[model samples]
Target: MPIQKVTRDEILQKALGVFKRQGYHRTTMDDLARACGLLKGSFYYYFDSKETLMKEVLWWVNRTSEQRIFSVAYQHELPPDERLGLFLDRLYAAVLVSEGGCIMGNTVLETAMITDEFKEPMLVFFTNWTNAVAHIYETAYPTAQALKLAQQLAAEIEGSLLLVKLGSPESLLRDCRERAINRLNVPMHDCTSNP
Candidate 1:
């Protein structure tokens, strides 16, 4: 058989799992290569360094979140309650409830102090997340209050995810979700309803 070509996205997808499980510092290039079914040398062809690969992984995650989670906040036809619930549900499914916890959170704790490059993408992720939640909250409150509530909700969910990672009951996440919906003060309805 001839040598197979690996796309950048394929490498990043495999690398993300390994990085999430083993963390940025603990994961070696060789480990990422194995995860992608490539030799160590081939891994270098895709990324000049682990940091470069990790940055792209963060970008990929941000793009995925924009599509699946943040977009719900922009659906003006949906009630705020339903939109918030859907966004939270999609978020939990995508990134929060994983055994490895939130990749952005994990990366922040590991690499925030060491490099500006890593921190920039992580900051963008949180800013985008906060803005999305704020947009939903704006349905009920003034711009200032809505932004405050959005920040609080974002922090609360992150804290809840940390608790889950530390062996707290997963219900903690569910409770956070309920509290967010209630805080928005919009009546709960079927998120799937046409709006």
Candidate 2:
């Protein structure tokens, strides 16, 4: 059999798991190396430092998540409300599959006091993601109103997911979906348009 090339992605994927479970500050480079089945010195051959590895991990996770969110958002030809619901379903599924618990948010919470490198990337990620979702919401509502709605809805979903992960409370996810739908269905100009 041809030798399976162990790439940097393969190493980062392993490191992501440890970071996901333990958070950034709690997880060590040694833990990442051990999880990846590599010696510390060998791991250094691939990454210059732990912060460098984390930067790559953040980029990889955000890129992966962006594709997933965009795919779900674009695939639906339905109304904006329905499309948003489907997008949420896809996003939550992607989060679970990635096992990273909102990589941008996770890093923000874990490293807020430590470094600007982590915080700056996270801000950009959230801004881009919220803007993308707002674009979809704008299709149904006035463009002027879509930004606030998108920001609120994204915050709700992200917070709900964190709660779910911390408490294993599935109902929180359902509650967030319900609240989002209620808020999204309201007209930007008139709250009673649907009725």
lDDT of 1 by residue, 36-77 (tens): 888788778889999889999999999989997999999999
- The digit string of per-residue lDDT tens for model 2 on 72-130 reads 55655776667677777877776666565776677887788877878766776778777
Worst 10 residues of 2 by lDDT: 186-195
Give the TM-score (vs. native) of candidate 1.
0.90
lDDT of 1 at 34: 85
Residue 86 lDDT, candidate 2, scale 0-100: 77
What lDDT does candidate 2 reach at residue 127? 80
Residue pairs that clash (backbone atoms under 3 angstroms), model 2: none
